[model samples]
Target chain A: MNHNLFPGFIGLSAALFAIGAVGVLVRRNPIVVFMCIELMLNAGNLALIAFGRFTHTMDGQVFALIVITVAASEVVVGLALITGVFRSGRGLDVDELSEMRE
Target chain B: MSVIFGLAAAVAVVAALGVVVAQRTLYSALALVANMVALAVLFLTLDAQFLAAVQIIVYAGAVMVLFVFIIALLSPGAQERLHPLEARVLIGGLAAVAFTVVVARLTLNGVSVAASGRFYGRLGPFAPVLVDRHGQVQTLGEQLFTTFLLPFELSSLLLLVAAVGAVYLSRRRRAS
Candidate 1:
């Protein structure tokens, strides 16, 4: 197909990013908030790949790969922290973890 | 093609909403899985065959399994409800809208400029014809290993650090 769907794909990416932002803002569960972060990262990857296709370059794809790698590492460390916090008898609500805010 | 793209995009948007709105954490995880699959389809439509595969394998496969496993391990109960008109929700919704508008405008303008032949960044050698001829994975792999080799190797090191950190963080605390 020779259709130019770049703009549409970008719009979709933007919408997804926005949804993820809202989720991150409003969700109390740390895991759900983490998932929203993943959603936002995936939206970024979509835009990267779309730009790659539009420009006939592989740089975007390579960058997206690196992004995926970083995201995976982030998830590992983040979940471990969450697990540790839960094991320490603290609740999982992000709003409740306000030790630093005092 | 447009029809399929539209379908996938719709699925992605709805699944994203599901992730945000699902009361149960497990349900939110499942909704994220659906969203990942829909994004893979979008990657395919964008002619990023290799990215589509990676999206499924890494995101939908490995990452999501990890998410579900953690959810199962912790079994964090349903999140406490927040009213639709809650101050937090209203503020977050408004911020998200403003962010979307700003980002969409910037992206649309950049894309239009690039499309209209005003952007002069030198296009890479891997044109669509060359990519199709050399195979998507092969071409992407070549560039990744060649031009992006340093970042690629560093990412491995980063993963190693993350693994060690996770193991240390999750390990049982010894009696002081």
Candidate 2:
């Protein structure tokens, strides 16, 4: 097995996920962290597809498709919420919003 | 065996690096998208056509975009903070590297998959199930409609409930 493309892809996806996770853990900015989370999700998508192909199953592909659709809808609604948060909180920093929970 | 694994390993590391190093959410999002696409290709090579498509449609397409859109909408001046993470990034990154090695070793230890991604031309062993039969989608639909209709319908209802809950959460809070 000399550099098979499938595992290569999986490896790349995993790398992306790791980076995203690091960003989430280390970044102070909420927006940046949010984006990193998305990056992680995408990485998982890649893994799913690779698994699907290897297993000769359509389930992974179908799940990926559904994920995409849900992502789109979520973005629309999420953005709206974010905008509202920004308006109220007056800043985009995650640490600043810690007060709202109480 | 080592060669193929190495390639996969290298790609994964690089893409992961890109996600961490990218300055903007858009860039990160793009990197993630690339990662997802690569996974899809990997899946295709593995002969998991169904999973590959779902990966594209569901995870890559839907989930990623939502993430991107949220960042775009909510993230204000996030780039300014990127430099801040640089302070302790070196120490943290080293740990990440160690983690990767351990996980990679584990993966290598478990599965001695065939050298080629495409071990079998078709699905089944020996001759493959080549019974066209309108493909997996059609058959899945038949199965769901006939045998697993209730679970399928319940899933839809659950999704609907989730949507409603999200709307409620986002609604403006009433002032006392």
Which candidate has the top score in TM-score?
1
Q: List the residue pairs that clash in candidate 1.
A: none
Indicate the TM-score of model 1: 0.94
TM-score of each: 0.94, 0.66
lDDT by residue (tens digit), candidate 2, A4-65:
45545555565666677777777666655765676676667666765555555555555554
* DockQ value of candidate 1: 0.72
List of chain B TM-scores, one per candidate: 0.91, 0.63
**Candidate 2: regions farther than 4 A off:** A1-10, A55-81, A100-102, B1-16, B48-75, B81-88, B112-136, B139-155, B172-176
Output per-candidate TM-scores for chain A, rounded to 2 decimals.
0.97, 0.81
Task: Please compute DockQ, using alpha carbons, for every candidate against the native two-chain complex.
Answer: 0.72, 0.34
Quick one: best lDDT, which candidate? 1
CA shift of A25, model 1, Å: 1.4
Give the per-residue lDDT of model 1 (tens digit) for B1-176.
99999999999999999999898998999999999999999889888988899999999999999999999999987566767899988898788778778877787687667666765245568777898899999998999899999999999999999999999999999979
lDDT of 2 by residue, B92-152 (tens): 6666666556655554543444434345334631111431445655644554576566655
